[model samples]
Target: MALCEAEKTFVLHGVEENFRIDGREREDYRPMELETDIVSHAFGSARLRLANTDVLVAVKIEVDTPFPERPFEGKLEFFVDCSANATPDFEGRGGEGVAIEISNTLSAAYSSPNVFDLKKLCILKGKKCWKVYVDILLLECGGNLFDAVSLAVKAALWNTQVPLVKQIDIDGNNVEIKVSEELYDCRKLDVEKAPILVTVCKIGEHCIVDPNVAEEQCSVGSVVVAVSEDKFSTILQTGTGSLHMSTLVDCLQLGIKVAQRLDAALWDTLTLECYTCSTTEDESDTTCLDNPSGVVGGVTDCDKKYCIIVRVDYKDPRGKLASILRSCVDKPTYTNDVIEDETHRVYYRSCRTAKCNGGSGRSDSTSDDNGSLGDKSTIYCPGIGDGAVAVTVSFSILLFAYAFVRYVR
Candidate 1:
């Protein structure tokens, strides 16, 4: 959208005064919501919503031949798709231009070996390697796409579980690979040094970090800096405006600082004590998600503490066990079965086991199945602590002005 002269002046004046039209200072980011593990079958996935811009990222890994030139390294490919619902310009191939640009920028951002180690994806040097595909879907755009997409991509990669190669057979020119049948036996991608992109828009005489569509229209040009640790991975300039070398230096410094803070916050979010099952309903899904088949489901970290599940049991007449899954429960309830009405001899067991809520409320379960609920609470177990540690742990969910998001991947 084009901004009229009057609207442009308003944004320009705000930047000059160090206040944006949204009332944020030049350095402050819009409050964000991030959720990971949304794709039930994908190795890893995450969705990010920054005010208005929304992006979904999923990572899938496959065994393939390594590049002949870079035999020791694996391949990582990025693809971006813009949804027609995002905007009219994104309808059909209209959004292809934007998608290509974003994906290309991401490829460049992670292209550096130091930023994301491709060697880790290598399974057997020259013969076999893990090719990772990161698919990004743009659900909406409200400006600052570079930053939003980068964060979402990082989250997805951080949660990605690279399959464990159990066996490899080499017969002359033929190679056969076998992966562990255990679903959780995969290794997480080390995204500790993943690049974080921050877009600093040059509006008037000042620079802004998180610009809205209106502010984007008022800008002369923008610089996107992808920061990894204290260094830069890639730098890009957008818009038709020119910037002085000195101003560009300032943008780089600002981007690095913000990227570092964002990185720390994201790490804290992932390591915090929060977990959930891939399924949101029934006792079968409640079993810590360890069992992808049979009596179990899959497990992952909630954006908060414990994922919400409609734990059901034959004992409970209604079978709607109160659960707050994936919203990041403050603490996982190991065993908290409270009796609603003692007159009926009804015993609603909040199993001491983390995953045994019975697909709940069904009259079919014979209590014998109840014994297996919490046996392996160790499955994907992350944070467990006494009351004191939980106090500090509760605050981890709110870091970065973040709101919790829930998805199954």
Candidate 2:
């Protein structure tokens, strides 16, 4: 449902209070998960899941004749595909409109020679040049698709492996090139200058970053700024409403500031050891599997520890699973029953068994005597059975004896 004027005003007030609809502050970004080199066939590939939005980018290189006008320059093309998985609305050519718009904007952003060093890809001037095809697949579009796509593209380019050129031979009307076959002999793209797009959505008197679909609908206008090294690579105004010149300028300044920081973080991640491609194919295939936590190697001692610190914000329901796992570590044996309250709140009542064998550290199992209920829901360990009940009864007797002694004293 679209937000009304009053609802939009409330959201604006929330932003003004430094709290967003999703409880994030103005400068805070949603949780993002990034994975690179997942596609085996592509020269470079990355998948980024920002909240609910999912974007996958793959880079493919093909040798082709350069344009006559710009013989020494290679080519970079952008293609965006809106997958059916994103939404039912985008099932059959439904997403083409947005796809074309995004692809066009990206092409324009990278068209400048300064943005990307296309000349370095030239093999033999006008005769032969490398054409890079950047294919973006939109798996989902909860919101902030543009920013997610841009980030994924930059990361994929950073992960790209370009074959080392050995020699180029030109015959009459034909040319041949030799690429080094050594596994370690490969070149990585210099993505230090890659652009990152930031979307500024203006809702009422406030501007927000990484707006969800509902927030986007509430926004009257938005500006997409692609910044590379504090420079404006592309500035695109989106949405139906108009913006004041003063507001637009302010948005541009904020966009540049955010992009610079984002770029720095991206570079830091890319330079880490985990981002580097493995020299051996077998090792490369196992890279992601080996590092389940996605900790990139070669990080400084301080940075390594920081990377391992998993922060769970209790306010987010998604964090409940982690909280539950942490609570179960010290208990030797535990049981839980799901109960629903009158207010419809559902939670678990967990019970832990007392120590058995007089603290001798022996493993014991437990049994339930609740007939059908016990049979359906109770969990018992091997060789425990009635032993746990006996142990509990003995412990109770000891506690009563201690209480009697204290009373007599």
* Candidate with the greatest lDDT versus the true structure: 1
Q: lDDT tens string, model 2, 62-157?
A: 988999999998888999999889977798999999999899888877776678788988889889888889999999888988888998899888
lDDT of each: 0.68, 0.63
Prediction 1 global C-alpha lDDT: 0.68
Model 1 scores worst on lDDT over the 10 consecutive residues at 378-387
Clashes of 1: 30
Backbone steric clashes in candidate 2, count: 0
**Candidate 1 local lDDT, 1-409, one digit each (tens):** 8778998999899888977788878877787777777788788888888888888899888888999999999999999989998877887799888888889989999999989999999888799999999999989988888888998899889878888889998999888889999855677788878998889888888877878999988888899989898899999998889999989988888778777777666655564332233333344444433332242213322333232232322345555443323223433332233334432222322322233333332232312223431111111111112111121223323222112321220
Residue ranges of candidate 1 with Cα displaced over 4 Å: 273-409
| Clash pairs for candidate 2 | none
Reference-based TM-score of each model: 0.69, 0.66
